[model samples]
Target chain A: MIDVLYFAWLRERIGAPKEAVESQAATVADLVEELKSHSEAHALAFSDMTSVRVAVDQELTDMSAPIKGAREVAFFPPMTGG
Target chain B: MGVRVQSAPFDMGAEVQAFTKAATGAGAIVTFSGVVRDEGGTLASMEIEHYPGMTEKALEAIRQDAMARWSLTDALVIHRFGPLKPGEQIMMVATASRHRADAFQAAEFLMDYLKSRAPFWKKERGADGASWVAAKDADEDALKRW
Candidate 1:
């Protein structure tokens, strides 16, 4: 099981801040694919890849990055902080 | 070096004074503060959300990079999260160096990284409704210059 977190608009759309998922996905992309099937909200929140950003184990990474031992995964929109 | 992420407000004047005092040999100090703009009375409030553990890590890494890329004596970054009223301070970055150029350049570099690379998301509440502040293409492009 790994902690999956959503932030900002993604959290609003998904209706939760975080969750635990049991999966055997090899990479972040595969995990995303698995998550997309979880529910309608998940599907809608993740439908467009360009609007979503992902981080594995708290560091920014791309979808192709492996998630073999990642303890946490976060999905959110591009940051607008300053 | 210091990187702080909190919901509480910080004293900008005191922070600059303290940071300057701490850097004994620094001949130049540059400080930049980002305030929540009212956007011409359209904005009611701004809410900032961030990844807890990751926010600090990302900020520390950015500060480290700035220190490495510039001749700096010290650096500091403080960012606030949670709901804030218009005109409130959102974040601040300060850099100390032996010369003005390094201090100015490092401060700008830190701001650029914090704007996009940091894990904080901003939501603006205005007369119409609340909306997530979208990332600007210019922000991403700005990083290319460094």
Candidate 2:
């Protein structure tokens, strides 16, 4: 099982900030595809991959990055910090 | 060696003073504070959301990067997450070095990275309603300079 987290509008759209799911997905993109199938809300939040950024194991990474053993995955819009 | 992510308001004056004192041998100290901006009175407030565990790690990594790239004695980054009013301080970054140029450049580099690389999101509340602040392409371009 891996922890999936959402932030900002994605959090509101997904309705939950975090969740645990067991999946055989190997990459972040694959995991996203699996998540999108769960519900309409997840589908809406992740409809456009470009609008979202992903971090695997607390480090910013591309969706194409492998997530074989990552314990945590976070999805959010591009940061507007500082 | 100071990195803090908290929701409470901080006194910038005191923070600068404390950072400078801790810096010890630094001849130059540069501190920058970002304030919530309400354009033309349209914004009522801004809410900042962040990933709790990752925020401190990101800031500490950036601080370490700055220290490695420059001849600095110390660095500090304090970012607040929560609702804030216009003109209220949102965050601050302070850098100390033996020379002004190093301090200035490191501070700017830290700011540039923080704008796009950090895990903070901003939502603006205005007359129309509340909306998440869109990420600017300019911010991403700014990181390319470093």
Name the lDDT value of residue A59 in candidate 2.
95
- What is the CA-based DockQ of model 1? 0.94
Candidate 1 - CAPRI tier? high
B3-31 in candidate 2: lDDT tens per residue? Answer: 99999999999999888888888999999
In lDDT terms, which candidate is top?
Answer: 1
Q: By summed lDDT, which 10 consecutive residues of candidate 1 chain A come out lowest?
A: A61-70
Cα-based lDDT at residue B123, candidate 2: 96
> In candidate 2, which residue pairs get closer than 3 Å at backbone N, Cα or C atoms, i.e. clash?
none
Report how far residue A46 has shifted in candidate 1, in Å.
Answer: 0.6
For model 1, residues B81-136, the per-residue Cα lDDT tens digits are: 99999999999999999999999999999999999999999999988999999999
Best model per TM-score: 1
Report how far off residue A72 is in candidate 2 (Å).
Answer: 0.8
